[model samples]
Target: METLMAVVIGVLFACAIYMMLRRSIVKLVIGLIILSNAANLLIFTVAGMTRGAPPLIPEGLYAPSGIVADPLPQALILTAIVISFGVLAFSVVLIHRAYEVVGTDDLDQMKDTDT
Candidate 1:
C-alpha cells in the first residue's frame, strides 16, 4: 500500500509540474491545486497508515494503553488543506480579475496587457 501510494504521489507531482509549465493561466491554477493535493498525500503516506485507537488516555491512565494514531500528521494535513483551499480560492479570483482586465488567459498574451 505504501509503495502504491508513493508511486501515485510521484505521478501526481509529475503531472502538477507538467501542468505548471503550460502557458495558460488556468493550467497554472490547476497545477497549484494538484501540487497541494500531492503534498497532502505525501504527508499522509509518510505518517504511516495504521488502524489504531484515537490518541487519548484511559480514565486512570496518563498515556494511551495501546497503539494510538498520531495526531500531529492529521492536524498538519488539515491545516494544509484549509490553507491550500484559501490560496486556491484567492488565485482563482485573481485570475478571473486578470482575465477580465487583460482579456486573455495566456501568460504570453497577458505580458502585453500591461502596456
Candidate 2:
C-alpha cells in the first residue's frame, strides 16, 4: 500500500508540474491544487501506515501503550488542508479578477500586457 501511494504521489507531482507549465492561468491554479494534495499525501505516507488506537494515554500512564496512532501527521495534514483551501479560494478570486481586467486566461497573453 505504501509503495502504491508513493507511485500515486509521484504521478500527481508530475501531472501538477505539467499543468503548471501550461500557458493558461486556470491550469496553473489547477496545478497548485494538485500540488497541495500531493504534499498532503506525501506527509501522510512518510508518517507510516498503521492500524492502531488513538494516541491517548490511559489514566495514570505517561504515554500510550501498544500500537497507537500518531497524531502529529494528522494535525499537519489538517493544517495543510485548511491552508490549501484558503490559497485555492484566493487564487480563484484572483483569476476571476484577472480575467475581467486582462480579458484573457492565457498567461502568454497576460505577459504581453506588461509594457
Candidate 3:
C-alpha cells in the first residue's frame, strides 16, 4: 500500500510540475492543487499505513487493542487541504480579474504589457 501511494505521489508530482510550467492561470491553479494532494499522500504514506480506527479514540489514551492511524498526518492533511482550498479560491478570483483586465491568458504577454 505504501508503495502504491509512493507511485501515486510521483505521478501527481510530475503532472503538477508540468502544469505549473504552463502559461495559463487555470493550469497553474490546478498544479497547486495537485502539488498539495501529492504532499498529503507523501505525508500519509511515510507515516505508515495503519488500519482499524480513527486517530480519535474514546477508549482512553492507551493502545486499547486496536491499530489507529497517526493523528499528526491526519491533521497535516487537513491543514494542507484548507490552505490549498483558500489558495485555489483566490487563484480563481485572480484569474478572472486577470482575464477581464488583460484580455488574454498568456503569461508571456502579461509580462510584456509593462513595456
Candidate 4:
C-alpha cells in the first residue's frame, strides 16, 4: 500500500513537471495544481501509512493498535489547496489579460511582446 501510494504520487509529480514545460500557459497552471497535490500526498505518505493511534502512555496500557487516521495531513492539504486556488485564480486572470493584450497564449510570444 505504501509503495503504491509512493508510485502514484511520483507519477503525478513527473506528469506535473512535464506539463509545466509546455508552451501553453494553461498547461503550466494545470501542472502547478498537480504538483501541489503530489506534494500533499508526499507529506501524507511520509507521515506513515498507518491510521492514528493512542498518543498517551499508561502503565502497560497495551493501547489499541488503530484508532483513526491522523488529521494533520488533511488539514495541511486544505491549506495547500487554498493557497493553490488563490494562485491559480490569479494566474487565470493574468493569462486572460495576457491573451487579450498580446493575442497569443505562447510564453515565447508573450516574452517577445515587450519589444
Candidate 5:
C-alpha cells in the first residue's frame, strides 16, 4: 500500500508540474491544487500505514497501548487540507479578477499588458 501510494503521489506531482508549466492561468491554479494534494499524500505515506484502533490512552496511561494508529499524521493531513482549500480559493478569485482586468487568460498576453 505504501509503495502504491508513493507511485500515485509521484504521478500527481509530475502532472501538477506539467500543468503549472502551461501558459494558461487556469492550468496554473489547477496545478497548485494538485501539488498540494500530492504533498498531503506524501505526508500520509511517510507516516506509515497501520490498521488499528484510534490513539486513545486508557485512564492513567501516558500513551496508547498495543496497536494504535498514529494521530500526528492524521492531524497534519487535516491541517494541510484546510490550508490547501484556502490557497485554492484565493488563487481562483485572483485568477478571476485578473481575467476581468486583463481580458485574457493567456500568460503571454497578460505579460504583454504589464508594459
Candidate 6:
C-alpha cells in the first residue's frame, strides 16, 4: 500500500510540474492545486499507515497501547487543506480580475502587454 501511494504521489507531482510549465494561467492555478494535494499525500505516506487503534490512551494508561495512528499527520493535512483552499480561492479571483483587465489567459500574451 505504501509503495502504491508513493507511486501515485510521484505521478501527481510530475503532472503538477508539467502543468505548471504550461503557458496558460489557468493551468498554473490547476498545477498549484495538484501540488498542494501531492504534498498532503506525501505527509500522509511518510507518517505511515496503521490499522490499529486511534491515538487515544486509556485513562489509567500513561501511553497508548498497541499500534496507534499518528495524529500529527492528520492535523497537518487538515491545516494544509484549509490553507490550500484559501490560496486557491484567492488565485481564482486574482486570475479572473487579470483576465478581465488583460483580456487574455495566455502568459505569453500577458507579457506582451507589460510594456
List the candidates' TM-scores in order: 0.96, 0.96, 0.87, 0.81, 0.95, 0.96
- Output the TM-score of candidate 2: 0.96
Question: In model 3, how large is the Cα lDDT of residue 54?
Answer: 70
State, as a TM-score between 0 and 1, how close model 1 is to the true structure: 0.96
**What TM-score should be assigned to candidate 6?**
0.96
User: Candidate 2 residues 1-115, lDDT tens each?
Assistant: 9999999999999999999999999999999999999999999999999989998899999989999989999999999999999999999999999999999999889988853
User: Residue-pair clashes per candidate, as listed?
Assistant: 0, 0, 0, 1, 0, 0
Q: Superposing every Cα of model 3 onto the true structure, what RMSD results?
A: 2.2
Q: Which segments of candidate 2 are over 4 A away from where they belong?
A: none
Q: Superposing every Cα of model 4 onto the true structure, what RMSD results?
A: 3.8
Q: What digit string (tens of lDDT, one per residue) describes model 5 on residues 1-115?
A: 9889989999999999999999999999999999999999999889998898988889999988999998899999999999999999998999999999999999999999963
lDDT of 2: 0.96
Q: What digit string (tens of lDDT, one per residue) describes model 6 on residues 1-115? A: 9999999999999999999999999999999999999999999999988777888989999999988888999999999999999999999999999999999999999989963
Tens-place lDDT per residue, model 1, 1-115, is 9999999999999999999999999999999999999999999999999979999888988889889999999999999999999999999999999999999999999997764
lDDT of 4 at 84: 86
Q: How many backbone clashes does candidate 3 have?
A: 0
Worst ten in a row by lDDT for model 3:
56-65
| Weakest ten-residue segment in model 6 by summed lDDT | 48-57
